[model samples]
Target: MWVRYLGFVILFGLPGALHAQPCGAPGLDGGYFVPLQETYSHEIEIIYACDSGRKPAVEGWWATSTCQNGVWSPEPQCIGEEDCLPPEIPNAKFNKKQNSWYNEGNTIRVTCDNGYELKNRDATAVCLNGTWTSVPVCEISNNTCGEPPQIPHAVIIGQKYQASFAADSKVRYKCEDGYSVEGAESKKSIFCISGSWSELPKCSRGTRQNTGHGSSVEVTTSAGSGTQTVGGGSGSSAGGTAGGHPTSTESGTQPGGGGRGSGDVVHGGPTITGSSTTSVSNDRNSKPAFIPVNECGVSPVIPNGVVVQTERMYLKYECNSYYTRVGPDTVVCTNDGRWSELPSCKEAFCVLDLAQYSGIGIRQTGKEYIKEGETKNVYCSYYDYVIFTCTQGRVTYTRCCEAYYHNYGGC
Candidate 1:
């Protein structure tokens, strides 16, 4: 039928022509369309579908979605990590209007008006990260995700003995004795989904290269969400969230990504913890010049840095909020400086989660990766708020408000 009226003119934008519709799936309301057979009715095929208990995040670069005419090519958006705000459920009546936020299967169709019927309610009341599940009583009885998320040094190849954990379960992630996941499909493993469990890949550890006078050391240990489990291995998520800065187990090779290091290697690498010395004198008499500290320590405050110090040993850097400076903004007075190689502020990738597109009235923010010409900003208040940049890493989209440019297909 003319490609279902060209996907209803690219989803109500009218005008005509323009077709692709990743199943017409929007967010917070559910997403996951599969109805088009009566002469292919009018067409609509969205996908993101979640809410039986929340837990359906799709954005590992877009999991899956394709349609090319009326738009809707690569729209995947149904993320979740436990975020149940707004009464979520006390009385209940969802498919609820969005202010921007909803995850996990995304459902809530309970009716307890007239005489109130639905004890162990199970028709739909998902949304798990923040909370909301089995919280449906309606004056009566009632009823009803994963279990393999413990990777700190990594280790779980064939360990079994579960008291509970069922639903396509899976587990085999490794990296314990010293941490490692340099490829090999990143060691791959972690499934249980729906009920929750997937999310754990990134062990990497072994990057201590100061080669100047040899003397650098750094160590970090974290485990505090009841003692860690569920990977929370922390940071690198990208797109679906977790864009840099949870760091700790870093040594360098790229492979994944994890920061922290560069305060002069943490303030102690001049024959091992001796630089921080201040005796500045460029040439007045030719003396007082001893400021080593660079194995990544001694001045590390990169949340959105600026750091600039010089007397002749030379040093200057910058990495404001939108961060993006990695190695050598300026550091001279040369003496074979490798000070263990320091320079990184990074952080800036896939942003925008108005609770997960609350109601879809229109919302977007950028970063989903950028480099080409640099530029990065993509916000919206209505619809079609595209404006992405970056060439080599690939991402090109544009609509109106182009503050910097969003990323990947949009508008």
Candidate 2:
């Protein structure tokens, strides 16, 4: 029987043990005996099955025992799936005073006022978790002014206005004499940021004095004065009339005086007596004396002619002669008449005979030789006829008479 029980325990596990409970059997000694009764707790331990063996028991595990009372029991099993928690949501807040935001993964944008700008972040921001990785802050941005107005007689202080300037911008003021600053005397420099000037310059009446000479003229203005002196022989003068009359002297004896006179008389006043003082005067009071100034002293004008002498011929005047100056030392004439140093005649020469024919008396063919005022012609020794002319003043000829008579000359 014991062997059968042991086999059952191995085949059917602990479940079979419940069926085998309450069995009475006798020992070899013949004494009465009962089957040993045992008790078990209802608790069990479970481990995770992984590639690296197993993890510590997290679920489906009992703390103390696996079985309880007379029943068979098992520990609860853990649901074996991926059990990771989702990421935590971030908390975000806006800082109204700072005009920015705090946190990561959260966004905040910035804008500026009309005349101002954002000194810091100009875009959105993000918040991540409990802790903000990036915090954005907005600051004041712009601080500038417009161009200052232009001032006459005053110079600009410096360059253009800077929104962030400390000092060093300055302007200076000045004016002519008798002029002063109306408001502030020492306040030549003005602060640019305030946009105010130092003061307006002012002008007052001034006095002036003429230094020298005849009519004294004065010009006065609110700012200053000017003076001018007129008349006198050797000084500066003023224009226009003085009192009611003209400023120039009325006496003709003065250097630039006007008077009525004729034939070189200094009139309207006294005259300086020189070696020759013929006090000439003019009857017409309206006209002044006329004194001509002499430019040419003692020069003579020569006539034009051609004068001929025994040894020289002076071809003086070819009518309407013209001379052109070329340079300092050269003069050119239109005609061919020119003289080097002296006027002299040139010797005239001419050939005595022109024809080669040999004859004594006039060989008259059908031609005849007339006297001075007549036309003439002669026959050549070899040809027909030719004409000859005599000298203007006189004419004479001598030849071999026999040769001439034999050679066609009728003796």
TM-score (C-alpha) between model 2 and the true structure:
0.15
Query: What tens digits encode model 1's per-residue C-alpha lDDT throughout 1-411?
Result: 999999876778854434433233333344344332222212344334554544344323223444445344455445454555434344345465453555443546666532233563344555554556665555411100334656667767785755335432456777654445532222556543223443455565543333233232222212111110011022211122221312223222212113233211221111101122112112222321223435324554555667664322335567775566665454432234334234677664434333343343335432244543344444456434444555444455455543222221123
Worst 10 residues of 2 by lDDT: 325-334
Query: In model 1, what lDDT does residue 129 have?
Result: 48
Every model's Cα RMSD, please?
Answer: 28.9, 56.4
- What TM-score does prediction 1 earn? 0.17
Candidate 2's residue-wise lDDT over 160-194, tens digit each?
A: 54343221123444434333232213124332221
Q: In model 1, which runs have C-alpha deviations exceeding 4 angstroms?
A: 1-308, 317-382, 387-394, 398-411
lDDT of each: 0.40, 0.28
Best by lDDT: 1
Cα-based TM-score, every candidate: 0.17, 0.15
How far residue 398's Cα lies from its native spot in candidate 2, in Å, is 99
Count of clashing residue pairs in every prediction: 66, 15
